[model samples]
Target: MKFTCEKSILQEGISTAQKAVTGKSTMPILNGILIKAKNNEITLIGSDIDLSIETKIKAEIIEEGNIVIDARLFGEIIRKLPNDVVSINTIENNSIEILCQKSRFTLIHMNGEDFPLLPSINENMIFSVPQRILRNMIKSTIFATAQDETRPILTGVLFEINNNNLNLVALDGYRLAVRSENLSTDNVISAVIPGKTLSEVSKILEEDDENVNITFTPNHILFNLGYTKIISRLLEGEFIRYNSIIPEEYNLKVIAKRGDLLHCIERASLMAKDGNTNLIKLSMEEENMIITSNSQLGMVREELNIILQGQSLQIAFNSKYLIDVLKIMEEEEIVMEFSSSVSPCVIRNKEINNCTYLVLPVRLLNS
Candidate 1:
């Protein structure tokens, strides 16, 4: 394959595709990025079997061919190359040569035929969504996904679309985050997308005003954004019935400034660092709310006047989980609903309208 392309554009394409390349794969070809040149375009692909990323960029094609080059080396070389135009050519001996100005480098190339085939996604059942909304949803919930591999389904984010609403749910047993938005589609479908794949997709998505088209099947999910398309394998399992976890009513409700509550919880978490249980105590007394954390190292106690109603109650929770949700909150104030000391604490952003956080309390050891 021979192509001459602008270094900046080429670098972006290589960097995006390389996100799927596995460094320690048993198959050596999986570590390489496939390059295909044809029709004045260069297509770059990288895969680790479960996830694949492909991008097509405009290039002046001198010869239409394909080859595989080491992803790591290719990325490094392209990143360090001068901003001038770059010329790439693959010879019959399976050697790829890169030239820019007076700098030249030769890399060993592998036959493209040996690379694994990526799944072909049909255009049917495809729906478009604002990239910003998708990115925000992922950012708000992906962090709560479980990192454990024991229950593979927990390691992914549950995407449910129904009745013209797009719902993104993620949980790590200890806490759960759910966000919903009104999308322009009525198609109903659900898919469990691995957290790792969503993270890689987030990186390739640029800051733009364009929308991305997403397609899903029984076994695979595809995302098409501009010239890039990402295909990821879907996890096979039933996600927890998250609706059952949400309390239908609350015994106590407290409204507080998001910033103030976030700071208080963060400071309280410092004392909880002494133990794996980052527990913080919450008590409602009259017109104020008390937040405290005690551990072997130290203790933190603070009070914030809040707009509260209903019966007074006390609860304990993992402060880290609350702080994580706080970091993603955009509203100035939030309503926190509590059912009981042992029940989950629900957080709702007033301005956001459709986002909620449910954090299961950490039982007091001495209770």
Candidate 2:
């Protein structure tokens, strides 16, 4: 393939597609990116069996052809190219030459026929959501997804669409994060999308108000974002019944400033970080909440003014878990509900019910 394109445009296309390139795959073709040039447009594709990314950029095509080149090498060369325009040409012996200003390099190309075909979704179950909103939904819940592969279902976020409401749920057994948004659809759909894939999608999404078209099938999901498309396999297993696990009732409610609580927990976690458990104790009294942590390194205690109601309680939790949810919240104040020191603590926005985070309290020996 021969094409000449602006360095910035080429770099972005290659960078986005490189996300799906398999790093240590047994198939050599999977490590390379497929480049296809035709009709003034060049497409870059990368796949790792489960996930694939393809992006197109406008180019000056001299010779319309297709070739597969090492993704890492191609990306590096494009990023370091010292000119505004870059020219790529395929030569004899399965090699491609890259030229920009005074710099030139040749890279051996792989057979494009060996690359696996990306699954195409032609189903009628397609929906669209604002890219910014979808990106926010993924970021808010993806951190709660389980990293362990033992229960593969929990490694993905549950996408539940009922009528116009869309709920995204992610839980790693210890914490559950749920984010809800309203869509303009009436279709009912449910799918378990891998969290890793969602994370990558979030990275490439633009911050503007553009809408992303999502197509879903029985075993795969496709996202079309203007010039880029991503396809990923859906996890096949029943996700845990998350709604039933969320506590319906709590006797104690504490409303506190999010920034104050976040800062206190961050300071408390510093001491706890030295230990294996990273435990921090929260004691809610009449009008104040005290956070304390003790470890082999040292101890930290912080007090924040809070509006407490219902009943007083003391609970211990992994400091990291609390910080994770609190850091993402945009509200000025947050509500924490607790049935008891042993029950799961629910944290949410004080004004809106758009998001909810449930964290299981760590058991104390004395309790």
Query: Using Cα atoms with residue i matched to residue i, what is each candidate's TM-score against the true structure?
Result: 0.97, 0.97
Tens-digit per-residue lDDT, 87-186, candidate 2? 9998888899899998989889987777788887794666888999999999999999999999999999999999698999999999999999997787
lDDT of 1: 0.90
Point out the worst 10-residue segment of candidate 1 by lDDT: 201-210
Candidate 1's displacement at residue 235, Å, is 0.5
Which stretches of candidate 2 lie above 4 Å from their native place? none
lDDT of each: 0.90, 0.92
Of candidate 2, the 10-residue stretch with the lowest lDDT total is: 117-126
* Candidate 2, lDDT over the whole model: 0.92
